[model samples]
Target: MTSTVAAIFVGFKQLGIADETDQRAIYSRVTGKPRLSLMKPPEKDAVLAELRRLGFTTVPRRANGRQQLTGRAAKKVQALWIAGWNLGVFDSRDDAALIAFVKRQTGLDHASWLHQAGDTIAVVEALKAWITREAGVDWSPTGKRDAAYLGRYGYKIAWAQWRILHPGADRIARKGFDTFVVATTGTTGMWTEISDAEWQKVMNALGPQVRAARKAKP
Candidate 1:
């Protein structure tokens, strides 16, 4: 697999594009997000134009839309994808509204949002800040703490189940403590869904820590 492709996958946030025909194929098509490096030339121009409109200069970035991505811009784009996908940033089902939401979100240079939506290394740091500064220490699931029980930080678990989802995979999020439910027929377990062993194999590589973590849970 190419790095760019890997980047796209790594960057994909599961948001359905306005024209998306197959909702299930997000994982397969978004490999490492090599496509992350790619901008619709128009999209790139618009982004640059926006930055300039906001008074930032268009000094040549290591990665420009017309050219192969490079340096900070490439990394930043990759980070955006990672954050977007990790956050499960679903906009309203309306395509136009969702697109507009995304533009407004990152455009403001939103610190907290960016921290949540960025790459692994960056997200961790942002998460630390988010927990400490914004949330003021993690709280119990019920918003109260008891002596015997410990609570899980939700944002920490935000991406926990993500690996189980694959390209073109149909995942239905369950209620609290809900592992994503999967089935073929767009729902209804009677038909049942087929899970690719290959995707499972990728998950297995998460190694002993993840394995033990799964084991430690019910």
Candidate 2:
């Protein structure tokens, strides 16, 4: 958890090296990251050495790799973790191309990615700008609008259901009576968002078919 270790860890994360194995070989292990690994060990070691000169210790790895750091270092790690999560670094299953694109655009290829206040601010601004420019304004965090017909909370309920049916769509383009219908359609009328009461009616209409299917099941 020393400042040096903190810096080194940040460097590893920036390089998208989240595997515990990779981290140990490069940053935590006495021998340093393996020369054969794809990781750019020289840059990581350089950063680690610089931080050591600044007074962070070269402590032995704890059993957990992370628990070895002092409480202060742990807190720094946690803060960095939250910052990384907000920036979508920990999302392994997310769009790999998008993550790579962001890394390239931000030049977060080193330990100094968020090393300063100004750097952090600039990274956040750049991320927002990239999201806006590439995905369009509808994807902005604040782009959500009230439902034109369903009022405030109703739209949320309906949208949640719609999302369950279509997991890939991230946001509703507009908040309107027709928005639900349009979003739920993949190839025209395959699905539709309905109110709770309306859904009850659907269930009632399908009750006979449901019973028939159950009876027909082998």
> Candidate 2's residue-wise lDDT over 94-139, tens digit each?
2333235446867742234323434455555665454334222222
The C-alpha stretches of model 2 lying farther than 4 A from their native spots are: 1-49, 52-103, 138-218
In the range 90-189, model 1's lDDT, one tens digit per residue, is 2122323322444453343321222223433443444344334421333335334431212323222232433323223222433321222222112333
Q: Indicate which candidate wins on TM-score.
A: 2
**Residue 124: error of model 1 in Å?**
11
TM-score for each candidate, following the candidate numbering = 0.20, 0.27
> Measured by TM-score, how close is model 2 to the native structure?
0.27
Q: What is the C-alpha lDDT of each candidate?
A: 0.32, 0.41
Residue 80 of model 2 has an lDDT of 29
Model 1 misplaced regions, further than 4 Å: 1-73, 90-102, 106-159, 162-218
